[model samples]
Target: MLAPFLIMLREGLEAALIVGIIAGYLRQTGRGHWLPAVWIGIFLAVALSLFTGAAIQLLATGFPQKAQELFEALIGLLAVAVLVGMVFWMRRVARSIRTELHASVDAALAGRDGAAWALIFMVFLATAREGLESVFFLLAIFQQSPSAAAPLGALLGLLAAVAAGWAIYAGALRLDLRRFFRWTGVFILFVAAGLLAGSLRALHEAGLWNSLQQVVFDLGRVLPESSPFGTVLSGLLGYREAPTLGEVIVYIVFLAITVPLFLRPQPAARLGRVTDV
Candidate 1:
């Protein structure tokens, strides 16, 4: 629950910040007429996200046991890709996001009435990217844990995101967004690595990958996954009490590489019209 809550909170805050920035810029630039288009985009993106999730859930209900495992594995891999892409993409654009957004807005407004549709499309795509990332991450987490916790975590995450978004917009929250993204990006690398290991396990269970089916370590005697603390660690950080050598190696190597890359801050550029909070 804590894992999902934090992941969703971080992702949702990002989407909220994007929308807020676009709206704020529109208002400040005396182009508030396009605000409706932006809202329309947000609504459509949300609807699409909900529909996509429902579709996946419905499809999963009809799958056989092995098929379900395969589905879970596939979703975990996809989530890993999306999660990594999002983190790296943000790192590359942390400084230039405002300039890019302003350029997009300008381009959209300069077009004809069709420009409204373009504006909506841009906002929709931005928000949907975040939404889909959340969906996949939640699904992977849910596969490893219980269903009841996922919904609760999602709710908590949404509430936190709303409050944080409001604080950011009101200039009440003074986050070092650069550092925040960097650290969180590093944290997500671990999450993705865990998902990768879990995906491999799922594939093995489904008989899709039979090459590396050996248990490298068995700590069930000392600590079992069913234990309270073990369960907590498993759910939050994908800690396997008895892990395969492959899993441990993947997790460790992932952190070792990703942490250094994330910690190395790039030179900040002076982008135009970036509101400092």
Candidate 2:
């Protein structure tokens, strides 16, 4: 539940920020009429994202047991890849994202010929990228622990993000988005580590990975997963009371490597503050 919440919160906020930036730019440049095109593009991107997720879920349900495990394992790996890429890329691009977005919009509006198409395409691509990223990340979480709470948490996170984005756009909120993204990026790295371990477990179950099947240590008695705290741990951290040797090794190794990398600061850039200018 916590995993999906954080994932969607971060991703949703990103989409909202991008749209806000675009809309803000249009209004400031006396191109408010293009605002409707932005909304249309957002709607199209969202619809595509929903359709893709539904198709994938419906397709996955028809698979046999082992095949299903393999599919989950594959999706988990893919999600982890996307999550890691997004985290690092955001760090690198954060300082200059506004400028890049503004440039893109300017280019789109440079000529009247196909101007609407250009605007819609630009916003659609940006938003769809964020949406698809969320879909994969959330799918991996659901695969780890299927429940109503996870989806609900994600939905709420997205709603909160939209509200917060609106507030920011209206100049009613001043957020340290730099700090927010940094912290959430760290949180996501840990979550991705757990998912990586979980994926290995799934691969083992699917018979694609057979070695290291031995139980490393059993903690079922002290903290059974059926218990409340255990359930929370399992959902958030992928804590298996009696995890296999492979799972334990992957989990430990992943955090050990990624955490340090995440902590290292990037080279400073000479970018200005976030603004519609």
Cα lDDT tens digits, model 1, 1-277, are 7778878888988898899889989999998988999989999988988888889978998999999999999998998888888888877776678777888888888868698899999999989989888888887788878658767987899889989988997778877776677677777887788888888888878889777456788878777888877776777667887777767776778778776776675654633222342
Q: Could you estimate the TM-score for every candidate?
A: 0.92, 0.96
Clashes of each: 0, 0
Per-residue alpha-carbon lDDT of model 2 for 230-253, expressed as tens digits?
Answer: 988888888899999888899889
Using alpha carbons, what is the TM-score of model 1?
A: 0.92
**Cα lDDT over the full model 2:** 0.88
What CA RMSD would you report for each candidate? 2.3, 1.7
Give the top-scoring candidate (lDDT): 2
RMSD of 2: 1.7
